[model samples]
Target chain A: MESPSKTYQPTSTPFDVDAIRRDFPILERKVLGKPLVYLDNAATTQKPSAVIQSITDYYTQINSNVHRGVHHLSEEATNAYEGAREKVRQFLNAGSVEEIIFTKGTTGGINLVASAWGRKHLKAGDEVLVSGMEHHSNIVPWQMICSEKGAHLKVIPINQQGELDMDQYTSLLNERTRLVALVHISNALGSINPVRRMIEMAHRKDIPVLIDGAQAAPHLAIDVRDLDCDFYAFSGHKMYGPTGIGGLFVKKAWLEKMDPYQGGGEMIKSVTFEKTVYHDLPHRFEAGTPNIAGAIGLGAAIDYLRAIGYDSILAYESDLQAYASEKIGSIPGVRLIGTAHDKAGVVSFVVEQVHPLDLGTMLNAAGIAIRTGHHCAQPVMDFYRIPGTARASLGIYNTRAEIDHLAETTRETIKLLS
Target chain B: MNSTKVAENSIQAAQDSIIEDFELLEDWTEKYKYIIELGQVSPGLPEALKTPDIKIKGCQSNVWLHTELKDGKIVFSGDSDAMITKGLINLLINVLSDREPREILEGDLYFIDRIGMKQHLSPTRANGLASMIKQMKIYALAYKTKLENAN
Candidate 1:
């Protein structure tokens, strides 16, 4: 495997990180009397002022139930809510607005497909393929549905560098393979899977694919149509939007055929004691009162990302990741966990004789927040034969100086613990 | 003093000394350094005793605690993968170990709070500090039952 630093040449384009940092209000706050250096982006990103204000505006101005009432407030609420759907549709470059279904987050989206699609299509002895690097969200839903359907859940193994074994993945694809669900970018190892090629491989076998884009959506520009995935799920919170609201982008063909995930008022076109008619594409999947403000906030988040552009985000973050890997890995006992050729800005490592939880606590005292433990990827931990790792995931707002501090503090903490 | 009173006084005395030691530390780093040193010197449970049955749940790191009744007193030994968690386990053992079941069950450990380690006791922290304390008392309750039955 090639070193990640050498794989991507750092762009010479200037990135205004200081100006970007000012956009997040929470960045001004200090932790433990020290200025905060938040590196837990893979868990959740800090919301910009625009996203925060959008949520505030929704409650303060509109504050009405959507798609039900005929009053002026309802009309405004309906437009804003539906407008957010349009924003998501454009964000993923999906074929139509009907493809975007509002969900609780990535977990909700995966569960929706695993229930609605899996229950309808899967048969006994059928197999669902998922990568070893998947977050628990991507793995458990399939496990539940597969067990219920008398189907099996098969894992596509990963190599030492945390890259998926492409040959093994191809061999795993067989006649009994019903679906392929994989994470676009690993939250634990920062490995960027060859998802596009993998999708094409599955397509050749007439098997549909679902891409868990929770980690990818914040960093990469997504085009669901280009990827041609059957389903793409992501979280709003991980992409500078409000929590409890996310999207599932299903292909139109699948949406037209799959059953409604839940039955409730908004999901029905007409209801009677004897019979009820389910609503159209997206609304059929979204039941009950939706997260109206959350959707609006996510729309504002999309607008913010579009204004800055993905070109700069990718270049700046890639450079930052490479720099971090070098600096942190230079420490005597520090071992970089993920050395994939292609990766996002997540850097996972473990120090010899120093537990990740101990490292995380010490860093917290210095106001440098990083995620520790198995990172909800226990299978990945088992593969490495270690308990867990200390992960410092980068975001667009982070600076090189923060990485420098992180490296220095990590060195001191390791010495103290050892 | 009677043996039971002696055991109770020793537990309180141990906690007070711990508090005094922590008070001398200047900053968070110094306090943590001292705790790590304590963990290094702590006698860990035997490998055979560190089984899944004794492992504490809800900890980010693995923690194994073993309790045994020796000469009418409960003896506690524990281990953790993380140094800080191990340090905390050592402190807990120091305050509660090698005491009669009734004395162990009735002991109120205030050193963690007095030494500014209250955050570790929060349920959300998931470091197993609170769980370890609860487990030690539970072992005491079980041993107390055994003593009553034997009598």
Candidate 2:
């Protein structure tokens, strides 16, 4: 008898997905008396044993506050923390380590930029341009800053296929446009935006751009210098790293001019009754004692990804995405929401007369985890006039058989509900 | 006994019957299938009554609940876009609807727990089962106060 969870072998590829699955311990676990089929990678990826071990090693061996103490343990802790920043710098191909600022997550990174940069530059009637497919994290921060500064928040619309209207995006760029913030990939729709071209368009107008790479960093190889995006924000957890640790990449020029994000211990050079001078580039924004263990864990995650290489990851995922799109789209009453030409390994669909919540609950009973909701992209949902979508986002560890199981169960669920 | 006392006893009896029915089901699929059947058979709230004012917030699916004081009992009519949520709503309506406001206000819904559907009652469950129960109790409290004012 053939195993239901048999690994799908790709012809003549060095990408051994079965071997990769062993790195993630959670994949071996069971949910609801069935093998767990995790399809919620867009929400957060499962951590590898290497990443977990790095975090454990930090707490067990090198546990101390960074930068302040003259003690040996402090130096070791600071080295590990700063080492993680260097790893992130390499991961994004950022010019310097000074360009990386540790943040709480993608939300925190965007909020920092909105507070620090927008507060200084934005004036009344100025506009911040964002796409309709942006996550709430990318949209809300700009809205908050815009409302405060009396600036306008303009949206570049997306078509029914979930691709951004590049013509409208170009027109939206004008003298009033202070900054353009865009998502590299839409989390809800799975559409990978042409960010490189968009960044060039913004640059042509001499307007700075911020790319929310929260979804992109996990799947794509980021080259900050090549893209030339002024600001790039990504969460570590999305890329199989620890929660509460992420990186924000700002150009050196902007970092030098922007105001400090927060005022506290690590951010300051010296503090007195009078005025206090802030620290250099990245440290000025760090403020408090950061997530030291999380940073170390993220470093390990970066190392693990580099070992597998992005070329193999992208190729394998493209195949998986194609398989999922074909198999899932063929189901009756299941309409694929985002039919963009370019997409990540994510399938967002809605079944006729079957709400996403119902489908999600039924799938959970079968031990298949998926994300169901507006995916924090309410504007995208509003554009499509859907309540939500049942999203199955793939990770590097996912198999073709798992996708087959998903499609089969989804068909059964729809039948049972109908 | 008074009518309110009889209504409370009926609510308990209805919950026991639901628990007994659920216990006979083999697994989650069977249990939810039964719920789905109940949802299919249950009458929907009139489209005119599904206004934003009556819609319950925080539910992943759109759910609208309408309540009225008919005679001495509070009647609830609710509907949800999701079948499972609608089924849960129908179950609640069965146990608590068409009962005296006093009975509804005091009735503890233990059937959801006894039937292995305790997850629905969790505050974080996007179905908003807990919120629906709370909203129903709020309606009962308001109707009870109205009765007192009228007397």
Candidate 3:
């Protein structure tokens, strides 16, 4: 919220991005005979060696399912898995371990809320409110359940700068508004919403909120207790961990009330033809043999972040983002999208007369990996009345020199295209 | 070059010509620039023909193709949302347009690989190219049926 990197405050590691880049082996790889400049962290991050090694170690040493087995391997594996959940609990500063439910990814977590919570409570005439800038993962699940329940899906609009129009958001809320689902940060535009304030406003009306922290978790230091959101969802892959693994942090009260999303072995206390009593808390939500290695890898990623200190990450990322934004924006025919006052490590822009796919192809040819499409946030694209914008999203290890190259190559690409 | 010409070998000849043209380009960037130029210069499809029914499914890029059975030869025209894809559409049009339905339906379509276009394409775009070819072949198959029925 404070002006990010206005006056540079030294990180604990003192902004040594080169050393951090070394932590990721993928950064060393060349693409098309040129060194790779990966700026697609918003889609998914490149795994650090610590995270990669953690997965290998889990498979090589302690490769067993957790919770049920009584063997020594099982206990070690269980400890590793649950330890990862505890790490997530600490990462978000949630109330307790009971609130942390591991799922497939951010989409799985949001769908859990939509199916379990929506089917139980939402009535025919209810309204499910979401911001216009949400990824399709956050939007489509609600639309599906809302359609089935005969509930209406309402969108809170954003301005040209991509900030939410707070007055409209307030006016849209009423007795029919059952829940407010919003993205903590826009994947398409890099707009950081004032979610704490939005959460407070929703809580005032007895309406719970779900923060899609898929983008936020990778960049910001998330504190669910501090934000006081009813539910938080994030993907491990976006945070330099493995794919097919993520977490959902539910308020304990909601966790107690919401029905089990899936009927599976681990989620059951006792299975009867008459009635199946569900397992308590996190187990009730986790239904299958979880991604064991992925969870351990996520824990390792958390450890990696902790070692570097999130304060350092925040400071360095802010500085990098500001410098990249200025550099990229200075290019002729490049129009920056989502120039929100409070932004993180994203730069979405459009070049005059060049399609995003062409631009992406051009960038790829030059050995930069950026996302170019609707970015799974088509509503934002529809609002802008464009097909897609080229997006360069940052990670903790990104250097200013790489950004300079990106900008330089982009200029050359535009020249060649024109 | 005639829209309804009765040339049988011209289709494959045109495919070879495209491959030759692409081989003259230095790199993927230059090849793409040529593709974009071809796409830009290619004729636009009528807005009415850009319907859902004519659209090729599973294409990462949106592509529409329309076929006309004229003078016993099938003429195909199409459009695409992305420039690279549009260029691909143009390439397909250049190769198969104004050819007999039977020749087009059974055409080699191997110039893409010969030109190293397949290697240059991203996986999604490669899928789009396949879909484009499939759509063009389907059009040819339809015209083949109509020609046989008339005969």
Worst 10 residues of 2 chain B by lDDT: B119-128
Question: TM-scores for all candidates?
Answer: 0.92, 0.92, 0.89
lDDT of 3 by residue, B38-147 (tens): 87788868787799998889886678888888899988888987777788888888888888988888788888999887886878888888888987888888888877
lDDT of 3 by residue, A79-114 (tens): 889989988899999989999999889999999999
Worst 10 residues of 2 chain A by lDDT: A3-12
DockQ of each: 0.59, 0.65, 0.40
User: Which of the predicted structures, 2 or 3, would earn the higher lDDT when compared with the native?
Assistant: 2
* Native contact fraction per model: 0.64, 0.68, 0.40
> What is the DockQ score of candidate 1, to 2 decimals?
0.59
Overall local distance difference test of candidate 2? 0.89
At residue A106, give the lDDT of candidate 2: 93
- Residue-level lDDT tens digits of model 1 in A1-418: 2211111111222367887888888999987678999999999999988788788777877889999899988988898899999989999999899999999999999999999999999999999999999999999999999999999999999999999999999999999999999999999999999899999999999999999999999999999988999999999999999999999999999998799978997999999999989998789999999999999888888888877789988998999999999999899999999899998979999999888878988888788999988999999999999888999999999999999999999999987876
Q: Place model 2 in a CAPRI quality band.
A: medium
Off by over 4 Å in 1: A1-14, B1-10, B46-58, B66-75, B120-127, B142-151
